[model samples]
Target: MQPVQAPVLGPQVDYRSLVVVLLSPLAFALVFASWTIFAVLGVELKRVLLFGEVQFAVLLAMPMLTGALAALPMALLARRVGGRRVMIGSLLLICPLLWAIAYSDVYLEFLLAGAGLGLGAGSLAAGLVYVASLCPRRHAGLALGLYGAGMLGAGLTYFLLPLVSQAYGWPMAPKLFLLPVLLVALLLWIFAEDAPRMPHAPLDSLAEPDGARSESPSWYWLPPPAVCRLALYYSFFYGAFVALALWLPGYLAAQYALPLKQAALWALAFTLPVGIGQIVGGALADRRDFRDLRWWVSACVMVCLFLLSYPDFTMQIHGVHGDIALRFSMPLGGFTALLAVMGMAMGIGKGSLMCLLYRDHGDDMARSGGLALALGGLFAAVLPLMFVLGNEWIGIRTAGFMFLYAALAVCMLLMLWDGARTRSSPLTRHSSQPPSQAD
Candidate 1:
């Protein structure tokens, strides 16, 4: 028999060699901002269109829901048409959708426009795949971090869009926004290079069976166990993070009775910590193993759960009907510390998860990334419904939800530890070694 050989890794890529890497990040940034347009614009849209809270929330979440479902399909589309073509098509599609949203006079029209929002955000799955394919294995972590910076683009919409809305009004905001997205797409067309496809396990070929194929019968295209682990982790990570992003503003306003402006400021504080954490987390993941990461993330979740459970102790923002006698002396400091911890954990966990997937999946990053994203989005849908139902039926609040979810996280972590241990055991035979061939 011919000797088995490891597939060759892509050549080491310099910063200059990977221009499309920048496009993925840029694409992600735009999608992040667009995905959040509802949160920023929902109130205005409600007033302009005379819609209810339920209606508004649906509109706000429709893009996210659709984007979640669209990721796999988008990945498939990218495979069929090419990432560059799909990305540009998605971006151009968004311009008309923005105009439709801007000019929409009815709820149905706005909802239709919301579908367009999903289309734009769906591009992220494809972009993640594209960027991962371009980077050398060693640099995937850094590339994910840079791609994560696109998440900060939401902050831009929150801060700048409001200012722009004040000056130009709500309808005009989307119209003006189109110019920048179009410009970025134009830049990407000129500067972004195509990703180089690498040889994969023949089992991994997404293409339908043609008459002939690669000759390597020994090769397999299965996703690495590490990638599956990352996907599982992301279901909890993004679910919790994005749920908080969607839920916190409402929680602050209703539970704490803060003025809208103050609540918005508080929400900003909450989000800012996550972005900071992302940077710190990405750096740590580059160095730390998943074993250490488990402890760190668990600890962060526990602390945040504690803080969230005790609003009176943590913030005292809620009005106390019975007694003003109770006080947590260092409430603000303690709350800030916990939030920072949670943010750092999320940041690190998010980047590490992507990095691990890339290490395992390598050139098949799109399929793996799409799976990760879809699972996370799936959790995002389920978790919120559970939260709402728990609130309605059992009178559980956000803190209660946090405590419950955090417990689930602990259990999942244990499961992962056990799984990892089993996978690392010597009992599993290597491809080259027979069961009776142990040395």
Candidate 2:
């Protein structure tokens, strides 16, 4: 008698899952919108708390360090407890913390609130892993890109939060923010599904039925090298962005000798473009038409460096502050152009690496995403320290330290080039495909 063939359950190919996948990032993004509140709020808090410069920087950076350390564990927890559970729980947990920050009287109490927010923000890593596991093989890039827009939520907050805080007061500003969080949390709690289990069937028969585990899937996890490079790249990429996010206003204030509000408004021009660039880069990644991401990313980096190198660019305007006349000159155009290019590079590079990693190592996304957060967090944590050290040693009169940041980006590109050359094997190539209808 001829041997019978086993049946395949086939892949769960659908676009509707994309919407579900996106919610995690969207929720996480909103949480991260509050992540930098400590940094933003610290400006006012420090005045009341009377912290030293180093202490202020510490408060600004510790949340990132805490969040980074928390990511891997959160990923593992999500897998065990269910992604929807952890995600919804995180949103709920953040509500009290945001409200607490508004009312805290003591500095230590406020810092503790910031730390609590960091713990809540760990949802981002879990969300990334959750989204990665949701989509079928083919649309992973586009799916991840849409989800990744959560990172841009910070830019939105930076531009808008101050205005809100000014109008409603800091205490009430977060209350308004929490409204959206509550709404998103409710939706995710009700709608998000747990990861589906592979159906089981009898194993004794030679001819296995459909949905049986007669054969193992061919998917592999992210490799050690790719993980290392990704960490390195994200470390620099996120570090640069974080450093800018924290210090740009201060830099502009000193450079132009502008008042606090004017400096912040000018910095908004620099940071807001980041969101636009990220969206544009995501659109590019979704198409997958841009094969050599390195070339485009490198070009953007070079343009950014060139624009940032020009020290004489001016952005001066007159403003009245309570009947006192003021004149300020900001490097608005130069800084904005540089930030936009960096944002574009970060978006393109991050999405490309994620697409490539998932394509090659779908099974390893949990680990890869964890590692990305770890290193990225470490970089973000250390960046404030770098700014302090750079200013202390060399002064902000030059771009020397900024070049160190640029060099790190260049090194990441080199590593990617090396990986492309050495690791592009036949099996890897074959497996690194988007899902097919037949998969």
Predictions in order: lDDT? 0.64, 0.64
| Candidate 2: 10-residue stretch with minimal lDDT | 1-10
Candidate 2 segments exceeding 4 Å error: 1-16, 197-223, 259-262, 268-273, 276-291, 306-330, 397-410, 413-439
Spell out the clash pairs found in candidate 1: 278-347, 281-348
lDDT of 1 at 120: 78
Question: Backbone clashes in each candidate structure, one number apiece?
Answer: 2, 3
Number of backbone clashes in candidate 1: 2
The TM-score, computed over Cα atoms with residue i paired to residue i, of candidate 2 is 0.77
Instruction: Work out the TM-score per prediction.
Output: 0.80, 0.77
Q: Can you give the lDDT of residue 193 in candidate 2? A: 78
